[model samples]
Target: MNAGPSTAAGSAELRGEPPLVVDLDGTLCYSDTLWEALLLFLKHHFWQAWRLPLWLLLGKAGFKAALAGRIALDPGALPYDQTLQRELEHQRAQGRRLVLATGADQRWAERLAAHLGPFEQVLASAGGVNLTSRAKADALVRLYGAHGYDYIGNSRADLAVWQSSRHAYSVTRKPFRLADGRHTEHIGSVRPQPLAALWRAMRPRQWLKNLLVFVPMLAGHALNAGALAQSLLAFAAFSLCASSAYLLNDALDAHDDRRHPDKRRRPLAAGTLPLPLALAASPLLALGAFTLCALFDPLLLAVVGIYLAATLAYSLRLKRMLMIDIVTLALLYTVRILGGCAATLIAPSFWLLAFSFFVFLSLALLKRYSELFNLHSRGQDKSSGRGYTVADKAPISIMGINSAFLSVLIFMLYFNSQTVLTMYRHPYFLLGIVPLLVFWLGRLWTLAFSGQVNEDPVLYVSRDKVSLTVLALCFGLALAAT
Candidate 1:
């Protein structure tokens, strides 16, 4: 909703007019407190989620009250409709009384009213009564008579109340037309780019990590047509499952993401992608992933299932644990290589697993180091959701650098192994990759120290020219050795 002040002037014409009534969810605020509270509850109490159905059996009002009592959503951090808020403030400045009527819990309604305005009264669901639709219309009519006050709303449920109001002002995607010939005007419209927002929410750029699923086939020199085809299928399945996990993670973190400087612009956190739509899309993506995996092989499906499970565990609980988060991230990366081995029917190499684990661990720690470095630069001591502080940044960098060198040593040892002698005609060419790895890792750490890397290192590598050059040279060296 992005209407300008000129649109608000229309309401000024009604001098000494009746009090203005405003809807809460989707009208005054860009998000629904009820849905946000429910998500927060599920996020924190996932182990006790059975309580949700039992609470809902208490009815909508009772369910909302129960959630409100359990979780306290921060009112100040909510994404309010700024344009509509300006209009409300203008009306208030004009001395017109304002009433906040919402289907959200009474506590949330009063909290928002106190936080954002001069509402004379707050009417919301309470004491087992869900004050919405017809009930809200009746209550307003009882207090101010039919057609005595103007109304502003943004959903079909508010149509009943609009029918009983003096005038209708809408902020929905489409304007409302009353059949009773009452005046109606569109104040604003929530015209989001649904397809673009959905695509962004999927985080397709992060799918680059799924390319690791091809490593096993490439490493074992299994580039036959069938092996290539199976590996491609495995990559697709992993990408889809990864996307599903990303969506769920974003939905769960939307509240806290809104407080982070960079993450706040994400689709779910910024309200560009609706929470309900994101939640619905996540399971469908996972189902599609499993279907693809099944078409390849049951073994491949089992591997993808484990990856999904680990990802869900990380998103749900492991991400907040101290060093466990980084370890989990590294293992998730290694799982992609394992998936490739399953797809290509290749025996996994101990050397490949060891090298990948340490390299990815280094990358994961680099990511956390960047985050904490940024926080420290901002004069903040602690990360929002993770278990890290500014003081941990130095040690994190040291650990990450050591891990990178350890991966290099593993790669050197793998070159000396019989496996490398049988696979590569000129095994010495592979040693050139070591210096490139060292240079890239050193430069990455330097960039992190200088605050040049501010996001996922994998993502940053995709865009960094130096990193890309290093990767291209590494691939060239491997091809030469083969």
Candidate 2:
């Protein structure tokens, strides 16, 4: 029973008359994905996933609707379900009005209604301002005023009203021939994950950070015997530690991860690898990493502890914080340098500590800027943490400039260092800074503006042919300086 537009394009035809009430969750949103997550949450943390449908049919849409309300936006809803336009139009032409009636928040439900476009009346979950279940019925009856409706809804939550409606029409893409004679129309195909999703999330780009392990080992070049062997061990151990951290982060971010498009497909998020097995394997993997460190100085254990704590805190609550979170990462990077020192017994020079802190923090800020710009440009900035709005220029302009300056100072400081200054006969690392900056800050800002740098700049830079060449030049110059 279609009526007037919800409040947008075709809604004006309602003439304050009886309109259709279509629910949001199953009818408009690809709610099954959300349902699956809730199902999994219930299974892993509460009960089993298979019993969700049974619970839904048991007049439990109110509870289910509340749960679904937690995650308001789906990652793939750039263009939500639009196939109902024709039928809605047909019904509107037949002198019926259209409205949205749901057990979801009126505020959030408004967005779904807007996407459907041009509805006259909207009846939604009034849990906040009004009652949701029976009150929803009261609102609907008041709006239609005995004219009644061909109400479209998914669950038994609609049972009370379905009996009151003139005709019951169920929207389900999955074929169903009702015993009462009406058939569920085939809407279209349900979308599946594309192959590219896996590649994006693995973020092969950020793997560049793993190379930092080699930095300590490379610094070990100052040591004479057994240095290479020790360095290789450190690299292996560090890689394992990083991988372990990644696994742990993904596990903690299960819900938020599912809300992210690229992140949603992570093996753990997609339900490809069950959490129990992953959780069981994590400590074993971490223990193996610790074993690698134990092969070196036992002091390396402290380094591993700090790494674990910092990353765990980041995954837990630190990530939600804004600039402080960025600085926390800056300090965490210092911890890595300290860890390297612990592993190799190399006392970190004051300059190295200061420079690394600034440079790494600069990189972290750029990473934030990149993510911020991407979200803003792509109209996905609701996930922002820096308290910046999509339209606000302060985060980008102020933070971006600050990070670039810090990085440039780091560049200058490295050149000004006696070690680098004395080693480079040609004074080339200074010149190399030009392209390095272009590649470092320039390419990153470019990718960010284009919304292509959601991952890490280092990883993306490594893949860029020009950036790779510049990095090679920097490395060669640094080696030459050595």
Question: What is the Cα-based lDDT of residue 463 in candidate 2?
Answer: 70
Q: After aligning candidate 2 to the native by TM-score, how far in Å is the CA of 50 from where it should be?
A: 28
What is the TM-score of each predicted model, taking all chains together? 0.96, 0.57
Model 1 poorest 10 in a row by lDDT: 1-10
Whole-model lDDT per candidate: 0.88, 0.58
Name every residue pair that clashes in candidate 1: none
Question: How many pairs of residues collide in each model?
Answer: 0, 19
Model 2 scores a C-alpha lDDT of 0.58
Candidate 2 stretches with Cα past 4 Å from truth are 1-206, 217-225, 384-388, 391-393, 419-431
- For 320-405, candidate 1 gives per-residue lDDT tens digits of 99999999999999999999999999989999999999999999999999999888888899998889888898788899999999
- Residue range 1-482, candidate 2, lDDT tens digits: 23223433353444444556666655554343334445335423443446556546635444455555544544333223445556676556656677777666565566666766657777765444332445666676766654276566555555555555545555543434444555433332233343343333334445456556556545434544564455456556656666666766665565566666666667656644444545555676678889877766578776877787787777656777757777887787677667667666766766667766766776677677666665666677566324445554456446665766666776676666776555456565456665676556666666666667655666666677876777677777656645
The root-mean-square deviation over C-alpha atoms between each candidate and the true structure, in angstroms, is: 2.0, 10.2
